[model samples]
Target: MKIQVLFFGITTDLVGSSTLELNIVDVATVADFKKSLKEKYHQLENLNSYAIAVNESYAADNLLLKESDVVAVIPPVSGG
Candidate 1:
């Protein structure tokens, strides 16, 4: 299945792109997608934590992804 991934904040720097069209095995879960991303982009593993949002809503690791789903990688935010 194919999904559109959006990178926010520092994630964009880590992935080297604000958006990506990626392919994954059918019925892949959010956790699976995160693992695949960490494998493909090792820099992503450097983050302390991040959130995965599917179709504008925060998604759990078990959420099953669907073709053409829009996923967003939102890195932790820090400010004074």
Candidate 2:
């Protein structure tokens, strides 16, 4: 399956791109995608927490991903 990935905040800095096209095994879950990303982007492993949004909604680790899904990597934000 192929999905479009959008990067925001520090995630774009780590990935060096705001958008990426990724290929994943058929019927994969968000956790699977994260594992693949962690392998390719070692810096991602350093994050204390990671958030994935599928089709504009925050997704869980077990959320299944489809070929047409739009995944976004939303970096953590802090405000005073």
TM, every model = 0.97, 0.95
lDDT of 1 by residue, 1-80 (tens): 88999999999998899999999999799999999999999999899899999999999999999999999999998899
* Lowest summed lDDT window (length 10), candidate 2: 41-50
Question: lDDT of each model, Cα atoms only?
Answer: 0.96, 0.92
The local distance difference test score of model 1 is 0.96
For residue 28, give model 1's deviation from the true position in Å: 0.5
For residues 6-69, what per-residue lDDT tens digits would candidate 2 score against the true structure? 9999989998999999989998999999999989999887788879999999999999998879
Spell out the clash pairs found in candidate 2: none
Q: Which candidate number maximizes TM-score?
A: 1
**What lDDT is reached at residue 11 by model 1?**
93
